[model samples]
Target: MGPLLLVVVVFLGFSVPPYLTFDPSLSRLPPPPGNHVYYPLLVAHVLFGTVAMVTACFQIWPAFRNNHRRGHRLTGRIYVFAGVLPAGLLGLYIGWHTAAGPSVRVANLVGSALWLVVTAIGLRAARQRRYGDHRRWMTRSFALTMSIVLSRVVNTVAMIVLMPQVDTTFLGSAELMRYSAASIGPWLSPLLLLLLADWLLERRKPGAARPA
Candidate 1:
C-alpha cells in the first residue's frame, strides 16, 4: 500500500511541473503590505522542492530490497548532497518569505528544522553502525519528504469538499483551496506521515525496535 501510494505521489510530483508554473505576482499580499522576497523565494522553493522530491524517492529503495549495495551508498550520498542540504536551506528561506500569517511561517520553519535534524541523525546513525537507529531516522526523513505529496492530496480533498457549496468558479475555488492547503498542509502532513511510517515499520518488523 505504501509503495502504491508512493507511486501515485511520484506521478503527481513529476506531473505538476508541466501543468503548474510559479507566478511570483500571485504570492504578493495586496496593497499596503507587500512581501518583497516572495517571488525569488518561491523560485527557490520550486527549485529545491523538485530536488528534494526526486532524490527522496531514491533514498528508500534499500529498505524494501535485499541488496544493500555500493550503488545504494552512492545514491544515498548524492541524495544528501543534492536533496537534503538544499532542501533545508531553501525551505527555511521560503518559509521566512511566506505571505500568509505567522502561524503558517512558524509551521514551515518547524518542519524545515525537523527535516534537517532527521537527516542529520540518520546520517550519524549510519556512521556509528547503528543500523536500527539509522533505519528509524531515515524513515523519519522520508516521512518528511512525503509532505509535498500529502499537501497536494489535502488540497485536492479540500477543493472537492469546499467547492460544491460555494458559488465560486472552478478556478477561484481551486486557488482558494491551494492557499488553504499550503498554509496548513506542510504543518500536518510531515507529522502524520511520520506516525504512519512508524506504525508500519513496527508492524513489519517487530524486532526493528531491537538494537542492531
Candidate 2:
C-alpha cells in the first residue's frame, strides 16, 4: 500500500513537468556566471531523473509481491538497463555541475551523491545474491529517487505554513525553502529506514535473543 502511494506520487511529479510550460530554465545557471557545461549537464539530469523515477517504481514490487519469476527477471533487467544506469550517470554529472550558491546547489550535490552511493550499493548487493541487502539498498535508492515528489510536497506545505508569517507572493524564497526540504528531507527517510532495517535484522539474528 505504501509503495503504491509512492508510485502514484512519483508518476504525478514526473508527468506534470513536461506539460506545465513553466520555465525549467530556472534551474540552469545563467550565462557568464554559469558553467559552460551547464546545458548538457541539465539535460543529463532531466534524462536520468525521468528514467530513475520510472524504474524506481518497479524496485519496490519484488518487496511487495512474492513472485520472483521470469517476468520479474525481465522487468528487473529493463529497470536496471533503463533506469539505474542513466540515473547514476546523470546524478554524477549533475553533482559535478552543482552551483556555487549557499542554497539549492548543496542540496542538489548531496542528493545526487547519496543517490549514486545507494544505487551502487544496490547493484553490488544484487550481484552478490544478497536479496535482503539488495532490498534495503534499493529502498534507499527509491527513497532518494522520490525526492522529486517530496520536494514538491515540502514546497507546497511551506507555502501554506509561511503564508501567515510573510508575504507568500515571494515565490523565489518559497521555492528555495521547498527545494531544501525536498532534497534534504527525502535523504533522511532512507537513512532512517536503513538504520531501522539493520537494527531489526540484527535483532532477528540467531543468538541475539532477548531476556524476555
Candidate 3:
C-alpha cells in the first residue's frame, strides 16, 4: 500500500508541471477550438488538483493523522479549501469541453462532482468534530481525486484490449471506437475503484465484540 501510494504521488507530482507551463508539446489538443479560456482553466485545474493530491497523501497517512494532529488539521484545511474546491469545479468545465465524447464528458462530471461533494462533507465533519466521518468522507474524496491517474491507466488498458475487438468497418470510424474505449475506462474505473475500496475497508474493520 505504501509503495503504491508513493508511485501515485510521484505520478501526480510529475504530471502537474507540463500543464503548469501550458506547453503545447505536452498538450492533448490545440486549445480546444479557439477558446482561450480553456487553457487557463486547464492549468488551474492541474494546479489545484496537484495541491490537493499532494496534501491528501499526508492527510491520509495514519501516522501523520495520529501523531501530528495539528499538522493534520492544517493540511486538511489546505486540501479541502485550496486543493479540491477550485480544482473540482474547473475539472467539470474541462470535462464538459473535452472533445472525445459524451462518455468522457459524463465521466468527468461524475468524478468531479464526487470529489467536491465528498470533500465538502469531510470538511463539515471536521468542523463538527466528527473525526471518524471526516476521515471516511476524505478517503472517498481522495479516491476520486486520484481517479485522474486511474482513468489514464484504465484508458490505456482498455484501448489495448478493447480497441482490437471493435469492428471499425461496421462501427463507421475506428477513431470513435478508440474514444469510446478511453471514455469507458475513465467512467467505469472510479466506480469500480470506489466499490473495491469500500469492500476492503469493510473487511478490514473489526466486527462488534460479543458481550462477555
Candidate 4:
C-alpha cells in the first residue's frame, strides 16, 4: 500500500459522514438505477472498503505480523472475506450509477474484479505456504484498491492543472476531466505501482519480505 494512499483512504473513510448516512446529497454519488437500493449499497461499500484498507495496511507491516501472528491472520480474514469481497461486489453494482459514465463503469468493474482475483490468489498462496507469492499478489491487490485515491490525483491534474482553456470538442469539459479520471487514470495506476514495487523489491536483497 502507498503511504499517501493509506492515509488518504483512512482519513476520507472516517471524515465522510454523509456517505455513511441515509442522506445521499452530501454523498455526491450519481443517481442509482433505482432510488431504493443505491444509498444503502453505497454506504455499505464505503464502510467495507474502509475497513479493508485498514486491515490491509496492518497486514503489510512486518513488525505487526512478526509480533502477532494470530492478529495478522484475523486481519487477513477481515480484509478478504468481510472487507474486500462485499465491497468489490458492491462497487461493481454502484458502477452502473457512477458519475464518470461508461468508461468509468468499465474501469471500476474490471478493477474490482481484478482486486478480488488478485487478493484471492494471495490468500490461496498463503494457504499453500507460498509466502512470497502471497506477498506479491497482495501488493498487487492493494495497489488496485488504492486506485480510489489516485483517481482524485488524476482528476486534479487533468481537470484543474492541465485543462486547456480553449478546448471545445466532442467531449464536454466535464466529460474530459471525469473520463480522464475514471477511465484513463486507473488503468495505468496498478501497473505503475506494481512496477515500482518490483523495483523496490529488487533493491532489497535476494530474499526479503517482497516489499509488501
Best prediction by TM-score: 3
The clash numbers for all candidates, in the given order, read: 0, 0, 0, 0
- The collision pairs in model 2 are none
lDDT values of the candidates? 0.69, 0.60, 0.80, 0.75
- Per-residue alpha-carbon lDDT of candidate 4 for residues 96-184, written as tens digits (9 for 90 to 100): 66777787777778878888898899999999999988888887777776667666566566556445632554245755655664566
Task: Flag regions of model 3 displaced more than 4 Å.
Answer: 166-172, 204-212
Instruction: Tell me how many residue pairs clash in candidate 4.
Output: 0
- Cα RMSD for candidate 3? 2.9
As for lDDT, the candidate ahead, 3 or 4, is 3
**Residue pairs with clashing backbones, model 3:** none
Estimate, for each residue in 154-210, the C-alpha lDDT of model 1 and write its tens digit: 756765676664446445565555465456677778878999988878876865665
**lDDT measured at residue 179 in model 3 versus the true structure, 0 to 100:** 79
Stretches of candidate 2 off by over 4 Å are 1-40, 62-65, 95-100, 166-212
Better of 2 and 4 by TM-score: 4
TM-score of 2: 0.64
Per-residue lDDT over 101-191 for candidate 3, one digit per residue giving the tens place of the 0 to 100 score: 8888888888888889888998999899997787777888878877777778888887787666667532656787777777877777788
Clashes of 3: 0
**How much lDDT does candidate 1 score?**
0.69
